[model samples]
Target: MFKKTSIAFAVFLTIQVHSAQANAQDQTADIQAQAQAETEAETKTENNSIEKIAVYGVRQRLEKAGMLSDSIMKTEVISAELMQHKNAVNLTEAINNTPGVRVSNECSMCGVKRIMLNGLRGEQTTILVDGLPVHAMIAGYYAVDAIPTTGLDRIEIARGAGASLIAPEAIGGTINIITKTAIENSATVDASIGENGNRKVGILGTGITDDGRTRATLIAQYDNRDQVDEDNNWVNEAPNQDNRTFSLRVSHDLTDNDNVIVRYANIQSEVFGGPMLGNTFADGTATSVAKVLSSFDDIESDMLFEGGDVRNNFIGKAWETTEWVNTQRDELSLSWLRALNDDWNMTLSASYSDHTQDSFYEGFSYYAEDTMWYVDARFNYFLNESHLLTFGVDKRSEEMRSHSSGETNPAYVSDAFDYDVLGLYLQDTWQTTDALEINMALRYDHVQADFIDTSKPGKEIDQYILAPRIDMSYSHNEYWISRLSAGKGYRAPLSFFETDHGVLDAYLGFEIDVDKLERSRSVTYALSFDGEQLSMTSSVAWTQVDNLAMLTKTKKTDETDGGVPLLTQLDETATVTTADIALGYAITDNLTLNVTAERFIYDTAFKSSYAIAPVEKRLTFYADWDINGWDLFTNLVWIGARDLSDYGYDGYNQIDSNGIVVASSKKSTHAPSYWTLDFKLSKAITDNIDLYIGVNNLFNYTQANEGESPLFYDLDGGYDVAYIWGPLRGREAYTGIQATF
Candidate 1:
């Protein structure tokens, strides 16, 4: 089916190109004649008064689209105006409408969310700030929620494997947050409130010194929300959160050709969710919220066993379990840029960051800390305009410490490690003609890792890797553009914290394969069109990953109960292919619409104990209208059904206490499809103030409607709450006011 669709799309593209060319040729004569008349009229009116003509059209939209389409590496830019119009409160909400990108909320307890690209797992994507890789270790999973959208210039997103030529960790692409610079003294404030006891406040300001040699920018934000329960089953569908973030940046000019920038950021958050008040079970284990919501429940079931009339035995029954996460992060960075004559420039940047997280799930406690230092230096040479060269070197050192304390047999299990990476890279860009450009990059990295375990006498691990990439772009005409890119990327060996967040205490006795590395090779092709009133983009990416690290259940020993699960890392091979098409048109002077369709096909030879993203297709539509002082924007999104059977949890067999094996519940295999509609309206109260209101999930669509809600129980009365496949929060309405000075 996918092959046939691809062939049809190719044919359609050919026809479109031909039609565009023919139309362009036919319109050439008309345009020339119109230009001649306009010139003659303007010459005659030169001695008279001049008049301003306002043409409400797609000029601004097309200009932004053109800038993105002309790049050698295909990139999608999300402007601040769009963010405000869509009422995006954070980075997660900002990219919800983007094709090939998804904000996946995996765990229900703490509401852990990550960005998934092209249907791949969240871990495959790399998050960056100002072109620097900052999400590492524990920060890679939970810290994404703390990033506020207070002072962003724009967000650049690359969707595909190996989308970044310099950052090898970008196997699933990159999300780079670009910061806005201060142009003059200004201040802004925004406040909002929503359903479910949600509230937010933010303030941002910028200033420049009288001498114009120094500038500063600062932003602060606070957000709080209660748990969300659409089904009203005494279980929270969305966790409660209290989050705060602050950032400050300053830039100073050292000389006419040199400048320095310093920045600092702090973030803190506390999130919790699970069974609330009045949560009680038939069994004598869990009675009230205070008793059942603070500890992990043991596996106990009343379901019939393999032997007729026999029931599974339970050791320690605790039905109440609440999930909680407390995290704090601090970062400081400094950078210096200098111009060496007219043809050369140099840059140096360094940063230090510290992150700590404390979490609890059903009485299981896990704590982790990560400290990292990074430095980068680069030089750029223009080399006479047509040719450009860039050389750079970077180094990073990170230390991770993780430990778990709970009622498990191990009592205490901890892992601590340190690693360092040093890399050198060179890139060259050549313009063969006025309409064609080629870019090539090569990089080499050396890594040294040391595991600290006094009981095992740890040893040092070292490895070397090489990466290469090539990108090309051609401008066929003013209305057509084409680009192609290919690259090789790799991720370093995983630490204890990266694998499972140190959840399972059984890992204390498990073995690990430290030599394995996750790597990928990918290729992509893109085509774009920009007409007088219409624009379109289409692209396809194919990626193959080798030695993919996957967590699996290992064999049990006599000392370990058959019920206790141990995790081990395994190497596997995987492939992902994705294709997407986007189209935009100006229906009228005050109305514009955009539509996108995307499809993904993933293949992995390894069948593990975890569930991967099962979504295969997505569709998105967006429309904006503006007239007078009122503005309206709307978005519609649809997701395809997924197969739960892919994770192998259909009536599985497990051992019982009597040394007998029994079959578990026969669960459903298919997750149904769902759709949502969001709307926003705003009106200008004054030149410096505006009021806006919006509704999300206007249809109140949810997975619960299909009996696939996150709240679920096994045949034996064992509760599990993390099987979410769709929107848990049904509907939300919010209103806010913004003021600028």
Candidate 2:
């Protein structure tokens, strides 16, 4: 499972120097200062509408930047100074330090490096590069890492559902990676070397032509590391891996009022980790056992002598074997923007992507392919000096074909899928007075699917989703404000769930009987103090997803309670309540302290008809403290887990009535809490060069489950299962030198 996605990403770079490469970028610095001044000057005239800060394009572009996922929060930006010190390979990692935001790696010790945005899973969130959807066909748990963060302006994160402007079912959130404009001719190259022989390199170049109106950006990155799982427990806490990624973006301002942009990117990555090799027996001789671990269901393992075990205790490997899992993604998209006037703007965007995977589990290999394309249009009208309106229409289609056949498993199948979606929505913002402002939005989404498989019933699913949001802010003074925001957003299942043929048999979330998808409604309240040198925001968000498709907690035979447990897609009502609060203080203008906490609760009974505590909580502390012009930041993250296993026998709702082998559904309720610390220091050695060092997982902590594969496997005989996720590398530290020339 070791390949690299970070290689070819470096080749796509356009080395043809453009006039925009001149990096004495006092212009960007001046523009930022002017934007800040303008915001301050209009802060009172706009009736305390400071949320409009940073919309002006200075060093970057923000055309597709919308608070698509949040109503209470407008567009936000984190300075590049904040990004320079961290190991930012993707947008999720770039925004990890923002207040009330989280980019969590779900299976940190796996073959694929996938990440979850916010609290929702990967499939639940939409990954948009320069406002275009990027389809990376990665192992479900490790797909997020394939995205390249080498050439970025900044990432915009919408914490709530932003279905009003885009497609529905962004139930968790949306991450939009904006690209830098060709403001100058500049190139930045950074290389890092760290623990476990880990090494990474990032190269970014941006150039502008056409008298500074046209811009081109190219970025490439590579990451390769050795495998070192020290526990010798037969499990690689984290697999050794290789990664390569590359992308190029070109933009031309057709006129002062119209522009067109095009971008292309690709990723190739691999990983390897398997069972440990050492075993203990009664005779003190080394022994191997059969069925030691299974990553896929269609393969047979001959590690041990079958029917020869004398004790319940099992000891096998200290890293005896490894597999190679490979994944690749290619994405292309084009966008056009036209400014009708100072108050009117229109944008059209289209994208095409192909995601391919050549993943192997010893004798079994899975080769899956997916291709998708979509187009969207947005229109914006400034109602007045202090009011704005936005509306849009979007259409998208996707197709996936999978040929999964193992050497020994006769149950393999080839499947195909096709899906289409269309949506429309509108939003309005108004300043009621100098002391108050309000925003309201609504959107509708419809989708259809076609599946080509004979083993499962082919069905067409259609859905109409509605999202509404309203946020009100009242200013008590120049330094104080109180706000209340309430919004409703929904998440539609991915095409794989409705159109992947038998893919649903692999997970419980897909096992649904209804013809419609699910929806989420939320409300949040916030209070903040914005002073001359400090900004503190405290917010609480609560949401509920009615008819959320959840896995059946109690196992049964033949789908019980009208629920599908075997990766069967279903629609069940679920309430996910989260309490979040954060504070960000800019101490002495050069330093900032940020801390956040969240309490999350999930409705497990909506699908199971039985109640369980699926509670989780998180706390993060981030600080950017500077010393003598050197910028340093430290982030500490912790996740409190709960026992989420329901060992119910069978795939049905009815329990075994026979007294002899009746399998009772006993649940395990306690999983240990996990914590990680990351740190980075950036020193501007010169105006054109920077020095940085960072450590990820300062404590070198790994996610260790106690004989449970729910996080990485489909235990119900569906998808493949993998145990001992290799040694989750501990204490990754890296140092690098970056220069802009």
Candidate 3:
């Protein structure tokens, strides 16, 4: 009895001692956290007047306000500082790492990509440069590659239908590129070389007048990369590219409160891909018939046995497979901003752009020329401290002329289309109280479209659309904010070039009616928190689309049918929902961390006909550290899998005796999830010089390898590069030097 009592007493004492140690550890952790918080609080108080825009490029981050004070839209700004830290080669590469934004590969032969936001297709988004309209119509697909970050100030992305106030076609989102203004004389040059035979060089120069009233800036860039064969099938997975661009901007201050800016840019690019290196027949025989035949013919035959269509009904013979892209584009823009008085301001802008494309794919040669003229006038009125109103009017005209020839009867044909639009908009912002704000905008647009078939002039189609938006924001305190917004977006009928590239000459006597305008309505809700060391924003949005235009197969009703297929426009409905959470934390005086999570879902009744494949969830993380003149930055992205059409890459479905294709037992296949990591390190040698090195795809991840083949071509013998889900190039390492004076 005495021994049992003594053991129980010793156990009780041991338990008490363990509890005391746990308490001590907890106390120590709390004290460290408190000390860190105090240091951050002191820093924030000192930088209260500074703007807290993210700085990642050559400059380091400075703790300041967490949000913008000028606008209420949920905008994410990426500065040139960040772009340099990420080692982005172009505008498309610079903006792709952000959450809710995707840069999609549309053509393997040309390495063409389009930017998408909030689960919507690339066509619904708008690209703006310095508040001017450009890169629309036929140029939208290939123009993103031409934009370089030589003299860029920043890039702003607003992800949602309601985020667009100046652009009516921004049903998905808006990407605005702001250029830097010269305040003092400066010059910068950089050069980089990487794996896969990649090479790049850029130069920028800025000069200011002695009186500080006039400034001029010039930028030039040259970049090239070799084609890569991911699967060792002799077929290029990524196209070879040779691109060059030159730009000039001049700004003059007419008065103390008035200024005018003029800008001009020219771009020339060439891209080459496919298995054939030169014009040659499938056999060992050499044939120079203005086109190249590739081994895809044999691959197509095998696909037919696996239930692939292999249909070239319109074109008389199976077209030869050749891939090449050539383009020339030029742009000029002018803007004048004047402050009429203390309570009023006026702005006027005008721009002209032209683009020409000469491309050939699978025996079909396509030539296109596009030109656009745009003008805008805006007036802002501050009626009182509580109310601000803006009125704007814009006029735009675009013309596209395209032609194609090869591999079909009556192969030579021309198509011409014209689009004209006039728009008027009014926006009002009312500060009901210091913490409550309401904003409303209404716009009316009239669009006129006409198509000519060289032989016949079609009747003109006119459409009138009304778009309205309302947004409200309530800030409970400096640390908390909430917002809600609803908006409507509209898109005019598409041009012939926007559809299939083979529609013109491939199909004899093909005809199509002007499609109805596409419209979208969306609503968004958001909440935000701001603190000395932590900042976060959470948002959810939903969008519904009507009269979505698409190309569909139809029976030919012409007298010379020739048993060929015809293409026509069809309308469909779709819904998209997106949710996002973004967080930023200052881990230490020289370290910062950021994380973002996004969920995107898309649904449509015409599931079989829809072509979009969206990921259900995505997560992105970024870290930046600067200490002792050394900077280190890293970015990681994780993408979730979703249902998508295999497109016959994983063997084909069985076909019955009947001509109709037998449906595969698997309706949808899950795209494999993927992760990519990138890192960069830089050291400042002097105030005006720096050295940097970076690695993209640090783990050598790729969707296709030496043994695996990625499906880049569809079953119908058409180019199908949209099935891309991951990186095509495995890894790239580059080092460069930047110098400023």
Best by lDDT: 1
| Per-residue lDDT of candidate 2, residues 350-468 (tens digit) | 98888876654433345678788889888777666555677888888787776644213333323455677788888776656656667778887777755555534665467676778
Per-residue C-alpha lDDT of model 3 across residues 530-599, encoded as one tens digit per residue: 7777777778888887866554445445532443323333455778888888888888979888888889
Ranking by TM-score: 1, 3, 2
Better of 1 and 2 by TM-score: 1
Model 2, TM vs. native? 0.75
Query: TM-score, each model?
Result: 0.83, 0.75, 0.81
Q: What lDDT does candidate 3 reach at residue 336? A: 81
Best by TM-score: 1
Better candidate number, 2 or 3, judged by TM-score: 3
Report RMSD (Å) for each prediction in the order shown. Answer: 9.5, 11.0, 13.6
> Candidate 1, which segments miss by more than 4 Å at Cα?
1-71, 160-162, 277-319, 406-413, 454-461, 495-511, 556-571, 606-612, 649-665, 712-719
Residues 377-446 of candidate 1 have per-residue lDDT tens digits of: 9776656546667789999889987766532445222356787889998876666675676777888988
Model 3: per-residue Cα lDDT at residue 647: 25
